[model samples]
Target: MPQSYVKRILNARIYDLAVETPLEDMPLISDRTKNNVIIKREDLQPVFSFKVRGAYNCLLQLTDEQRKGGVIAASAGNHAQGLALSAKHLGVNATIVMPRTTPMIKVEAVKRRGAKVVLHGDTYDEASEHAHSLVEEKGMTYIPPYDHPDVIAGQGTVAMELLRQHSGPIDAVFIPVGGGGLCAGMAAYIKYVRPEVKVYAVEPEDAACLKLAMDRKRRAVLPQVGIFADGVAVAQIGKETYRVLKDTIDGVITCSADEMCAAIKDIFEDTRSIAEPAGALSLAGLKKYVAENGVEGQTLVTINSGANTNFDRLRYISEQTEIGEQREAIFAVTIPEEPGSYKKFCSLLGKRSITEFNYRYADNRDAHIFVGMQILPGGNDRQEIVEKLQKHGYDVVDMTDNDIAKLHIRHMVGGHAPQVENEIVYRFEFPERPGALLQFLTKLAGRWNISMFHYRNHGSAYGRVLVGMQVPSKERKQLEALLSELNYGYSDETDNPAYQYFLS
Candidate 1:
């Protein structure tokens, strides 16, 4: 029988470690969306993540024998930090098995909390298997990140705070889903107490275990997952969490890497708090929701899940924010490769600030001008610029929506591979992480001969992978079908002029 989690959630002892973070109103986002945008500042928690609530509560409920043996966990990052802090608080020994490629900042954080930090394999799969081995060998109690009942109940405390703090009408609460713990917990409690207040789950499109599970109506395992948003990059939703989530969660909102960057930028501008990629997911979902649907004046809330981002990762986030927010528009312009062609194109731009311009003449007849122009904030001028350029006899292709242009070509202008035969070029968006390239190869490598491959790390929620595969004209549809089944955002660049002139 399933226990009443609402009752258990209210009874959980977490305040000893967790803080009742303030609910802040986002003025800029509210004005932009024509709605009341509020954020739950969980990033301000002691461990800089909401994981502390679950960790402390779970540890407190453990049997005396289990506590004596200490605890062990396999975490991508944030859970380990939470457990470490919880263990320190309880004066118990804790051992954390973390992914080897986890950012140095997170690894250092676990160590600072006095936990035995074990850097295992590169992915969560590898780290998980290793953690189980440690539990057996060291006689430690294995603490499941989101699967256990105690952990779920502990996380539900967030809803308790939310309902108690705010008396106004809440249209929805956006939560970031990793293993579904937070979503499951909050959704269960909120739906029980206030069914009208929808609990929306936010996830990275590349690593959306809960979304896939919901679509299938069963728990599904992801062979490959993106790690750009490291904190919530779980391969599969937890059993207990999934069981609760399948019934209670109102909707799932998926966000792209670029959109997440935009959300992070929004948070930084408003609060000067640098939330991690996963931390900024809820706002990304909120913005995505506002853009896609015609909803306004409703109050929405999203949690700043954590602030454990790496220092160097800021470069990736900062670069993509302009495009993500539509503050800058990029385009590929085709012009006559004559002496005055550049001047005429500049005139068509009409005194707009040029963020980037890369002009390379492939031949004497035509030249490809890669350019970026600053767009007015909160204004829709992308299509207007395209129409204005077309009116002036300039052929322009809006590259703002093109992943290859935004990720690779804009940064590195001419790297044309020479003389490839029967090659079909396709640009794919894969989860950005350590083994993503290898995972792509593992899926479709042996069947086709990869003629040319170019990958650019955009530091967004996803990695940009451009692969050129040699396939006969007769078998082109077969390749298309395979790619369609893969369900990744991809485009055929085989007939692109840039490829014809420079690479192919």
Candidate 2:
């Protein structure tokens, strides 16, 4: 089956729109990881993503009648821009149905490419349904984001260029997976041409649809998926893509959000290019593989998939990079609330630099301090610091891996509100769109009295809000029902240790 795709990939008519992206060496990452590391510069494509290759190739196969009828697709961002640009080049009309939560920049980009942009529902599924309806009504062909043979063959061109560009031996290739189109295509080509070179698929930890599918030995849909790497936040691997990838891919690696952020920084340092979280996903997996296996002196390659990230998200990415790189450790330590206690604590820390120190008076007997310090890149250093503090008779709780602590508590470390009773804390992520906050407040505020609230914009597809509301025990079920009706992703955090230490 893999052999069957070789000719189609070689003959894919994408050169008119898609350039042959270069394979560039990452000198800094190569030296740091002790491997000859290189990256496929797919991010440098005209559409700033490799999606154009498949979009154009698929369009080239369309019959003259299909071209006259045009094409329709539902995409969060990249795919829409790709199809729009491709259609413009071929003189075919395109209709793109995008989620309302899609960033303005992408919507405008599609419009500028002469595509009719339809702002549909909050999620891709909703927009996709609307797109299908339009396809029937307008008698247009439906262009799936990543499920067709033509598209897969088109994406395989990346591998064709990669192997041709680098004739030297390559140990492995890392490709990021969303609906698995790029991974499936690339893996098929690589396995067919060079069976010894392993192909690994990379996915976000919270959006590991391909990994789950591989484990289950069948395609499975995720109930929900995290959208931090919005480009690859697909809840299900495509039917056709899963078919090819299940056989061709050597393994799957999933990385956390923090790890992806660190990879973004890594790409920036090596190439001076800012990659979107999904764009840097393969590099994150490559780093994890090298560290976990203690691998060295091998040639590794990964693709920089895209570079269409919103500028505002860089702040959040920068904040998490230190922790992602294991260069920062955060903890909650209790000390006596008396004179010279701070000095004593500092003395114990010795020469280590403190990244953050937040404390507020709670009682005379003991005081809880939220502290952050620089640490070496390994698990051992963080553990040593924790053990040292505990050995000094100080109660220490590691907050470095705590989501609430890093995202909210670090910015809201104030004394506990003793007077607030029956308070329940919940973290919620809702579609980030106009009047979304107002709608959320209108539905949630009337029944329960708000005790605490914190909201920050990371400029992704969703808005995260932490809310503490006072609901009596008897009315807890009512609150749950209301939350279910609200239809937002939420998690109760009342028992979170970060909140227990600083803001309960």
Candidate 3:
């Protein structure tokens, strides 16, 4: 036996996948990396993900009779869609078992591809177990999501594309690991073709099964997986993928929900395409690795493997971006419960925009009044800001340093102020672009006088604004009710404590 039969099978699997999928050199992202950073755009493949490569390769190795019986697969989302679509194209019946918690959008996508969709348990592992049982009961081919050699070899096609697309030797390749099929396959191929190149496997912190497995020198299982990055929320690394990957990978890393969100935002801004959180894991890992290890001057490649995402997930991503990047600060200010107190507090604010204002008359306390403000991001002097407020006899609670603000208030926020009889509080979700604020003000015109206004522009698609306008009592009802017609929301906050503090 010159070479083992298993080794030959792995080689053949990789060969088959390379012929079917196209590779693209992502140039815009390359310039930023400064090391001829190329992307294996597995996201652009036939199923809009690299999963098809592995699923199809695995199917091709299946016997014709088994193919006729059809295939069953369990996926967080993408793999189900991939296997179902590929199986349909190959004229094989596909039954996809997905978690009940799986987004309707992904379920519809699988159904649209002509696959039988079965909503099973609450998590992928449960759905996968159900599919495995079906394999024995129905004599259908059970397509392992990431553990089989065929699947790994199919995933290796991304490495082949990168090697062909880029001119120089790759210093490192970053791959996102859910069950580690993609990373294992990519690492195996890279090791075989270019052994010197570093292979990095990235996983979400909540689902770092592969990294934990590597550290323990064995497959590690997580009690529960994180659903934030639903695409890679594997509670256990696949056994076969682990065997292929254990020694080939250089290191394993973890990323937070925020880091993933920031990476998704970066990739979107760079390419105008939204990547699923798992797809952005490679980039997130690269950034974390580079910053931590101080690694530089090496050509890097990250596999942007999938783009299927729930549009609603973008809201969570946007909410986490600022905290992950440390670009926004939230604070609570205690001003005097007296006349001209609001004016003094405003004067203390130097070149800062208010993103939030939560003030309530907790008690008839004269010494303190609670107010929350989200300061503009970057280069903030927390001490100076606090000192200035204190100089004006206002106590400052830097909620930026408070856990409550970090966890709750930062995300569940809208501009809030006290309600006034003649004043109306309107919430405007304007585009987060320069001059957008001015356009909103211009739209208001001379009909309403600005009593109080608050706006802060985070790097979000839309900015939230709370404007307090003093309108005649006759016009107040009409003004408050007219915003809905203009596509904005108005709440009569005249009775709100925060509003009364600033208004009266």
Candidate 4:
């Protein structure tokens, strides 16, 4: 049976370490959706996340002996800082085992809070495992990021503030879910007090553990999770949070990394504050909910859960925002190899603004043109543009949502591998470490020649590389063996359309 969670929230000893964050009305999103949209600005917390509340609440329950023993925990980013700050406030030592996938800025922030930082494996689960091992070795208290009663109650304080801040009718409350502590606490309180108000839990599509749990009627573990929204990229929902979610939350929604990036842009445009991907997750889900359910003029509220964004990530986020919002589209068009063909193709687009155009001339009868166009509101749909080009006797392929087109192809428009045979293009992501690239190259052992290589560091947790290896058919099995031994996350992209069209 559920305890009196609202009472527990009211009594959670956390006010000394956490502030009552504001509930700001979002005029831009509200005006766009024609609804009263408000954001619970938990991002304004001293720790830049609502996590401090739960972290402090959990630590407050520690015995004097336990506090003296210190605490151990694992986190991707936000929870680490929250717990670190809480431990500092209570004069307790904190050891945070964090995933290497966490951004450098976040790692530095956690250390700045006076926590002993342990950079472990690539995922939160791996970090958690290391933390648990420390618990047994050091006899320190293990502070879970979520799944505990105290933590849940502490997170419930968010809903308490929400209900008190706005007594008016609210159609729904959208919350971002990772381990689900925030959703569990808030949903339980909201359901107990204002039963009419619906609660929605939002997650990234690449890591929708709550949605999977709801569908299966039990806790579900994801085989893999997206790293973009690292704040909420949990492989499995916490058992305690799943229990509360099943009983109290009305629905679960999922959005893509691109959509979250778009939400980040939306928040920045309105509030002049940049939110991390997980912080903007609730707003992304809200947009999807409105578009799918045809919701209009209803009061919807979502929490800006955290603002612990890495400044360098803003470039990639900005690049993806327009595509996420459907305000920009890209295409590859085929036209005749004649002098007037370019002029004719331009005429077909009418007055639509062309954002990009890339063409590499080859001695062929037909030529391909990679084009990017601005998509105005209330303008012609992408398909309409394609159809118009088709009517003009030009073949077109839409590449707006093609990740290869977005990530690599557009950057290097065309580079034909003339005589390179058996060229296998592979994309790999490896942990950023000194001599990492050299180590990978050494592991290959000169079995194959590298025909092409491309790498750009935009300050991500991992280094991304696009490599074209000239491996013969007879050596394919050998190459696979080497890759398995080297053990880097990779994908074979030899047959990718972007590769075939732009770089073949």
Candidate 5:
């Protein structure tokens, strides 16, 4: 065994963890990124996290007298459950103080593991303060989430496992940061054993307490944390953990909610495991850091710390995956107003699947249309579509993979303008492909303009389109003739009630 392995043996007796987690090389994800990426599946640990290793190790180190006195802990979720289970195994009384805003599932989980639960305050800081007061008032042992030498030693066991199970030297290790327990422990241990390996800490951009602290060269506190990634939504890093992290960790990076979601999906596709946003932070960090630094061909290991994620959040994850990866595109297009103009426009999208479609032809102004579509997975032909639309003088605003488009524009703004007149509505089935829409736009002729349109690709074989056109009623015959030539399905909603409100 190596020195790192020997250290684990000396310290193994201190932890109460029932099982050691495995480090498995993820071939699917490795191939996707064109690098050797291995995952330390801490999510599969007995506690569904490496938290048990530290929580139990800290408790076991206490003298018999301290055990008799009992113990207290503060956490938003995972640590609470870890301590609760550990105290139960040790036959010691444990009380967990959680913020009142903690999710019901987490609160129940802590209690289910046989710990007395006390809900206090709205944030973790307030709850931690209350826990401290209890410790002083009742003389109970306080088991902190991190910020202790013993905790760091115990959490370091994760690195112990990685070195033992992995065959190759790790180029980089990405770890998620909260109170900085995991990063601090892993960094200290890795540096002590393998001085050449690099350690990186990742945090949610909205709640990047560690990143902020590293930049300021002091402990920094955030006023609010985004609860989306609940596990790592900590406002401040622990003092002792920060001491180890400030110098031991090579760098700190922040990831956006969207990027994290995409990472989660990618990991799920590869490992068939659902990682919480916090758990996905390490993978997201690796992607961002690698891209920024142009790192390539490096063996990487990212800790999948915990997966205690809510299932409801998966819906949003699925919906935004394309948007997160920039595979979906949204556009605003303008066409000449005329009766058959809508059909001619649909011909432009050759094979792109439409995810959403809406149109209004009641009111009129300049023919401005909004459209959204999910391009085929891994498709990168956006410029080709733009060129086709530009050739026919169709002005388009591309919003694919744009945060502003997904969060705001995709569902907002469409239909006929009340200020304009002679608008008509038509819905068409267009092929969902990169240049399909552009070709239709190129073939369209005349002075008639497009008033409103909505189209989004859903990664399907066919596309559904909604378009509003402004043109003379006499041009209706010509538009029908063009539709007949296109040989695709069509629906005319020129008189629909929705057309009236949006167009009027």
Candidate 6:
């Protein structure tokens, strides 16, 4: 399998549309990790992604009859742009089906490339179903985003370029996995040519299809997947790509969304270029591997997959980077409600940088202050700070890893209303469409009294919402049924420690 892919990759003919991206050194990353860190600059491609290489190669393999009939594909963003540009260059008509939740930046980009853009469901899977139906109805060729052999072979060209560009002794190469195309392609080529160099597949923790498939020893589907790193939010590994990857790849590494955000910041600081979450995934995994294995003086490489992120998303990414890198810690501290208590707590904190501090009076006995403080990297300082506060008689609860706290409680720190009885808190993922919030509110308006509501746009495909409703115990099941009927992802946060400490 590996040997066969090496030949196909060498002959891929993608240079007509895709440039040979550079293998550049990251001096800052290298110094920090004690490894010779390097990045494959695929973000510099014509489509600002490595997808163009595969998309164009797939098109080149199509028959003249097929090209005349045109092509169609379903993609969240990157692949849509790649195929659109490739088809435009080949003078072929292209039709792209994208999720309605896709960012406007990406939708406009596809239209700008002369492709017919159709906004369908709120997920890639639904968009894909619609694209396949169009392909059947119009008798057009359906260019898969990743599953096909030609696509895999074309993606393998990245490894071909990487090895040729840098002839050094590389310890490992990390590739981000969505439907496993890039990982399978690169792993096959690398193992065939340089078997000694390790190939690791990286995926977002919430959408680790490859890791789940490896564990099951077969293709497995996730019931749900997080779309924070929307570019790689695949629920299942592609069949063909998985076949090659299962035998060729060394291992799989999964990373959190925060870690990916941190990697985005790292790429920006080192290369002065903002990488999309999926683009920075491999770097996030590389950093995790370095920290876990404690390997020093070794050569490591990661692919910066693409830079097609919306500029507005950077604000949300920036907010999470500090926590992702373990440079900041959040806590709910109980201090005295009496005068001079706030001053005493500040004296205990000394000169540490305070990232955020929110407080509201609840009672005369004690005060719970939501605080965020800068901490040294490596994750130990956060616990050390907690112990110091505890030793000083400050009852502290670490909210650094609390999802509710990070997502909502931090913003609603002073929203304590004890008088409001039967208040149940829920966190929901609201689609980013214009009427989504209003629709959500309308569904529950007459049935229940809304006690609290909070929402913040993270500039992704969805918005995070925290809602509190007044419902009697008798109507609890009815409320649950209504939420189910609403068909939006949500979680009960009524008893969540962060909400209990701050809002309840």
Ordered by lDDT, highest first, the candidates read 2, 6, 4, 1, 5, 3
For candidate 4, report its TM-score.
Answer: 0.96
User: Which parts of model 4 have CA positions greater than 4 angstroms off?
Assistant: 1-3, 377-380, 456-458
Q: How well is each residue in 1-504 modelled by candidate 1, as lDDT tens digits?
A: 124998889899788788999988899889988999998899999999999988889999988999999999998678899999999999999999987756666778999999998988766778889999988899999988888888988888888898888888999899999998888889989999888998889999989999999999999998777767877888899988888988898889998888899999999877889999999999999888887887899999989999988776788788889988889998888889899888888877778999998865566788777889999755569888999989988888887876567666665565444455678999888654567667667767587889877776533445677878988888889888878766666889878655553355
- Lowest summed lDDT window (length 10), candidate 4: 455-464
Pairs of colliding residues, candidate 4: none
| Candidate 3 accuracy as TM-score | 0.72
Each model's lDDT: 0.84, 0.93, 0.69, 0.87, 0.75, 0.92
Worst 10 residues of 5 by lDDT: 1-10
Least well predicted 10-residue stretch by lDDT in candidate 3 = 1-10
Give the alpha carbon lDDT tens digit for every residue of 1-504 in model 4.
345777788889798889999999999999998899999999999999999999999999889999999999998678889999999999999999987767778889999999999998866678889999999999999988889989999989999999999999999999999989999999999998899999999999989999999999999899877677878978899998898889998899999878898899889888899899999999999999998888998999999999987788788898888888878899988788889988878877888888888888765788777889988643459888888888778778899878778877888776876788989999887767667788899998787899988875546667668899998889888898888887788889999877787787
Q: For model 2, how does the per-residue alpha-carbon lDDT over 1-504 read when each residue is reduced to its tens digit?
A: 888888889889788789999899999999999999999999999999999988888999999999999999999878899999999999999999999999898889999999999999998999999999998899999988889998889889999999999999999999999998898889999999999999999999999999999999999999889999988999999999999999999899999999999999999999999999999999999999999999999999999999989999999999999999989999999999999999999999999999999998887898999999999997599999989989999999999999999999999997589899999999999789998878878887688999999997788889888999999999999899888988989999999999999998
Off by over 4 Å in 1: 1-3, 376-380, 416-504
Residue 192 deviation, candidate 6, in Å? 0.3
Per-residue C-alpha lDDT of model 5 across residues 209-230, encoded as one tens digit per residue: 9988988999988966666677
Instruction: Give the TM-scores of the predictions, in the order they appear.
Output: 0.85, 0.99, 0.72, 0.96, 0.75, 0.98
Write the residue-wise lDDT of candidate 3 on 416-477 in tens digits.
33354466555555543356556566666667778666654332234456666778778766
> Alpha-carbon error at 423 in model 1, in Å?
9.0
Task: Report the lDDT tens digits of candidate 6 across residue range 229-309.
Answer: 887989999999999999998899999988999999999989999899999999999999999999999999999999988
**Once superposed on the true structure, which residue ranges of model 6 sit more than 4 Å away at CA?**
none
